[model samples]
Target: MVARYLVSPHGGRRAHPDISSALRAAAARRRPARIEIAPGRYEETLTVRGEVELTAAEGPGSVVVGRTRGSALDSFGSVRVHGLTLVGREADAVGCHTGTLTLDHSEIRAHGGVALHARPHTSVTLRDSVLAHGRALFTGGTGLVERCRFTDAADNAVAVLEGARVSVRNSRIEDSRIHGLRVSDAHAEVIGCELTGTGKAALMADARARLTVADCVITAVHAEGIMFIEQSRGTVDHTRVTGARHGIGAASGADPVVRGCVLTDCRDTGINVQTEARGRFEDCQVLNSGNIAVFSTDGGAPEVHGCRVVGGNVGVAVIGGARGRFTHLVVEDLTNTALRVFDEAGAAFAHVRVERCSSGLEVRGNGGTTAEVSDAVFRDVEMAAVAIGGQSRVTLKDVTADGGVLGFGVADEAQLRVTDSTVTAVSGAGAGALGSGRLIARNLTVTGSGSLGVYGTGSAYVDLARSEFTDCATAGASFDEEAGGQVVDCAVNGTRGVAVAGNGRVDTVRLRTSLKVVRHAEKPAGPPPQIINIFNGPVFNGPVRDIQVAWGNENVVQNRGENVRNENENEADAEADTGADAETGTDAETDTDTDTDTEGNGSRS
Candidate 1:
């Protein structure tokens, strides 16, 4: 089946058009062929109707397929255009069939209309070809481009319109005003390419397809770096994207995984997952952005792990009914909230985690919803280390809030819990040793504070068990209006042990430290509640020295606040008129406030 021909536009004067025409005729005669054109300029349109092999004497810059009124070649099955230049013309340059079209070592330049239009069943491969200054290459079937250069197309440079799977490798697609590569309802793989310039996007996925851009440099885009408009899942790995409106954006359930990439200098969110889209960024460096580094909104959950986020308005903003989880992430140097989980009206933050932020963690709530926080470390925070309000539930376990303005703030019926943790050297008001909530603190240590460690306002209850308080200006446990607390087996080594407001109660509290004056606005006409110390360590100073039990008040300090009429080595030191009538009785309701001057007593029940 060996067939041959020649096409020479100069009428066989230089062996180009004559070789092409002869090859076309031979291919039309249904014979397998190889038509090699020598170095010459062809000014006529070339067409390969049958199976033909059209090659050049040399490579791209060697053999020139010059301008013609029509296309260079209308190829069919197995039409190979290698090492040839298809220059600008008035009509379509190259139209092909559904078979394999291998275009390599060549340059396909400008055109009045379409550049290369592959038919429905064509499988094209372009290797080391330069597609520059053209309308675009429209393809319907699969296209594989390796080491190709696509530059300066007014429209989409390479449009995969219908169900095409286009894979590009080691390519440079730059300097285009429109999309560098636009794939609608098609799959694309862009690997190791430089997708840059002032284009709309380096890559745009419009429909439900899969696109993977790996080990690529996508920078300086006009609008966005890469966009997944519909249900497209794009996986970008080892890539660097900078100077774009949005580094990576997804809409309508676009699940994208960005791994090991450097996304910087983005005008908007570095990674925006919108409309039920899911994104994951692993071991990436995202910094110096104008907006939030990663913003997940509209019912999306984007997980960021082992990433460094710095120098943004917000490090990671999870708002508008979206949730974000940060595991093993380092977020520091933020202009606004490090991780803001904000919602309005019917929206809420499903889940968020600030395992360890460099500064602190701020949580806000709206519309009868709250925020939950735990297991974090705060250092040198400008404001409260953990601010919980608006009916929020914030818990801190094994947390160390060091040198913050406020260690923890609970307002508006917010709940806080600190377990096995320490708060040291903080200089602020309101909850140092303070606040109102169901504050459950166990095995806790509060040292070197400016104010009280646990102070509360309004019906707040504090339970301290095996907790130690040291070196505070105020009492170790201070309660404001109508608050009740219980301290069991706790050591308070401060200026005072307990200070209670009007009608406040402290039960079974052992104050081994000083028992100072409880400042009341007006001494209650009725007997105020007392502090019952069960297992007394030692009365370092005078106990309840400011109390006058003569005004219809009787038993102040009981043995264990248990029973009366029993002398169980638990003595109440009331300086009554008759010191001889001070009998040890098990009266649990005794209004007698006792100061046990006798120290070193054991087992008072």
Candidate 2:
């Protein structure tokens, strides 16, 4: 049982040449031990209790356990080393406790401290190894590192603490001058690894650590290239992060479940879930980022699905009191606002698509912020394609903004609710309710606007009902008189001049409309715009009560040209002494067409 313990008879007689007298003559001959060392330097201070086999033949200076002042292999029992080289400086180059530290094709270089020093319930195994410039390599216990290589670690190059349990496969953690894999109340399994230049955070699992990263490739991290803070929970799959500052970072109350990741460039905010963290990101790809590419703030509740963001500079920024759920997203080409909801944040995005964005979707905040979008699309937007200002609140369904310049902008004191929308080819104002704003739309459609395709002025409140406005160059629903709105059963064909314009003091109100000369001469036996210009801007039959029609008995609603203009003439004896409903003097007016509905499509002025 002697395959060269360097010229035999070590525990069978007495023959010891260096290696600390052949490990004290194989620990006073208490059994199992085999040492076949050939070519050189073993200034070793080795000490093993039970079984040990330190074999070597050529390679890595052929068996050098150098100048150790303390630990250069001080296992309290079972140890196996094949092709050894523990070039220690002043300490630890392997020191397991109730030991089992196996290393094949070994090498533990420049160890000034910990280069494999497992403690409680020790167990360390590495194949094709290299744990360089150490300060760490399994500090607490149980482990396995295959195809290993952990470089320049002055501290933390694989450190699993307390309740330790580690497993790393196809490894390569490079240039770590600090933290390149540190799991806290431990349990980590990184597969197909490659983490580069970590001066911190190139995979850090905090407190209640339980990490499982799969198919990883993390590059150039100076911080946060996958970090989960306290209360940390598991799972991150198919990861790929580059140039980190924050490429996948979850904070304090962490609860992770990320999948299919690919985060790029990032100098800040590339997928960061905050404080009360609770994450769940799927099919991620956050690119270019120099700021804000998905950031859920303070009170986090992150849940992003089917994500994709390209060229970030504010593409998804939910602030402080965050609560999120971004679904089926694709936020592209952003240099600014592409969903930047402010403070008291509460989010919900479904089936989103925002392209070539400069400003598409921004719900302001004075706290109370809220945003909800469904089946969205904002294309080639260059500012204000959905911007609801301070005191925020926005809700949209089936939203679409094509080639926008300004479509849908509600001002300070904000609140907007749109349903079944479409804002096409806008140059400006295809739906805008100014300061003190409040807009409630239903079945909206605004096409090719160069101005005023739905505009309500200051002290605003616009309620567009069953809307549709086309080719507007001037007005297709313009309001003033300290704007207060109500445009019902709307329809404006091609506008170039006043198609439903209401001026000072009329407080803007319309019912069952179809003007602009009956949609430009196509079938105009005209008789449906009932009250001249049907409540078009500028004095709707003024004198106080203001343009409230549908009480026909004398039929004098004008404007067939030829200079005819009567506009709400006395309203059927002033609404038959208030009995109302002469078409609609306002009994809340029902049937504009089909199944009765005067209010409740959504209201809150």
TM-score of each: 0.75, 0.44
Q: Point out where model 1 deviates above 4 Å.
A: 1-20, 38-41, 64-70, 88-92, 135-140, 344-359, 367-370, 429-444, 457-467, 473-491, 494-517, 521-605
lDDT of 1 by residue, 1-605 (tens): 66755554555553434655575467567877777777777675666655677777554576777555667766777778878888766666777665778888888886655667777778888899988776445456888889988888767777877777888899998888788888778788889989888469778887887788899898888887888877777788999989988888887877788889988999887888778777777888777778778787887777777787767766776667776666666667765556555552121222223322333554445533334444556666555555544444556677766774456655445566667777777643224222244567787777776555655444566666777767754455554445556666665565533432223354534434443424331222323333332111111111122221111122233332322433433344321111112111111211223333333333321
lDDT (tens digit, per residue) of candidate 2 on 1-605: 43235523223344456666666677778677786666667676677677878777465446677674666777787878887887766677777788687888888875567787788888978898788888555656798889888899887788888888989888899988777888998898899899999888888899988999998899998988888999888998988999989998888898989998899988987889988988899988999889888899989889999999999687888888888999999999977778877778889999999999777877767748899999999998775667766678889999998875566767757889999999988765577776577889998898887655776665777888778888765556666536666677666676254455454322223443334321111111223332321110111121011111111122333323243324543232222111111112121111111111121121110
The CA lDDT at 580 in model 2 is 12
Give Cα-based local distance difference scores for all models. 0.62, 0.71
Candidate 2, residue 319: Cα displacement in angstroms equals 7.1
The root-mean-square deviation over C-alpha atoms between each candidate and the true structure, in angstroms, is 13.0, 14.8
Ten residues in a row with the worst lDDT in model 1? 534-543
**Which of the numbered candidates is closest to the native, going by highest TM-score?**
1
Tell me the TM-score of model 2: 0.44
RMSD of 1: 13.0
